[model samples]
Target: MKTIYVTAIFIFMAVTVFAQGGPPATPIDGGLSFLLAAGGAYGAKKLMDRRKNK
Candidate 1:
C-alpha cells in the first residue's frame, strides 16, 4: 500500500513537470484550412440529407 502511494506520487509529479513545458504554436493557415474542410463536410451532409428526403 505504501509502495503504491509513492509510485503514484512520483508519476503525478513527473506528469506535472512535463506538462509545464508548453506546447508548440499553431499555424493560422491550418486554422483556415480546417474551417474550410469542416464547412465542406457540413454542406455535403446537408445535401445528402436533402436528396434522401426527396
Candidate 2:
C-alpha cells in the first residue's frame, strides 16, 4: 500500500512538471450530425417494430 501511494505521487509530480497547454483549434461539424441522424433512424426503426408487435 505504501509503495502504491509513493508511485502514484511520483507519477503525479512528473505529469505536473511536464504538462503544457496549446491554443484551441476549430472543431469538426460533420461527425456529430451524422451520428445524430443515425441514432434517430435507429430509434424510429425500434419504435416501428414495437408498434407492429402490439
Candidate 3:
C-alpha cells in the first residue's frame, strides 16, 4: 500500500513536471458543425417517423 501511494505520487509529479510544453490548440469548427447537422437531421427524421406512425 505504501509503495503504491509512493508510485502514484511520483507519477503525478513527473507528469506535471514534464508537461510544460507549448500551446494545445484543437480545431473544432468543421467537425462540430457536421456533428450538429447530423444530430439535427437524425432528430428530425425520428420526429417525422413518430408523427407518421400516430
Over 1-54, each residue of candidate 1 has an lDDT whose tens digit, in order, gives 999999999999999998795778877998899999999999999999999999
lDDT of 3 at 24: 85
True lDDT of residue 1, candidate 1: 100
lDDT of 2 by residue, 1-54 (tens): 999999999999999877856668767678888999999999999999999999
State which candidate has the highest lDDT: 3
Q: Which stretches of candidate 3 lie over 4 Å from their true place?
A: 1-21
lDDT of all predictions, in order shown? 0.95, 0.92, 0.97
**Per-residue error at 25 for model 3, in Å?**
0.8
RMSD of each: 9.4, 10.5, 9.3
What is the Cα root-mean-square deviation between model 2 and the actual structure?
A: 10.5
Residue 16 displacement (Å), model 1: 41
CA shift at 40, candidate 2, in angstroms?
0.3
Q: List TM-score per model, in order.
A: 0.50, 0.52, 0.57
Q: Tell me which residue pairs clash in candidate 1.
A: none
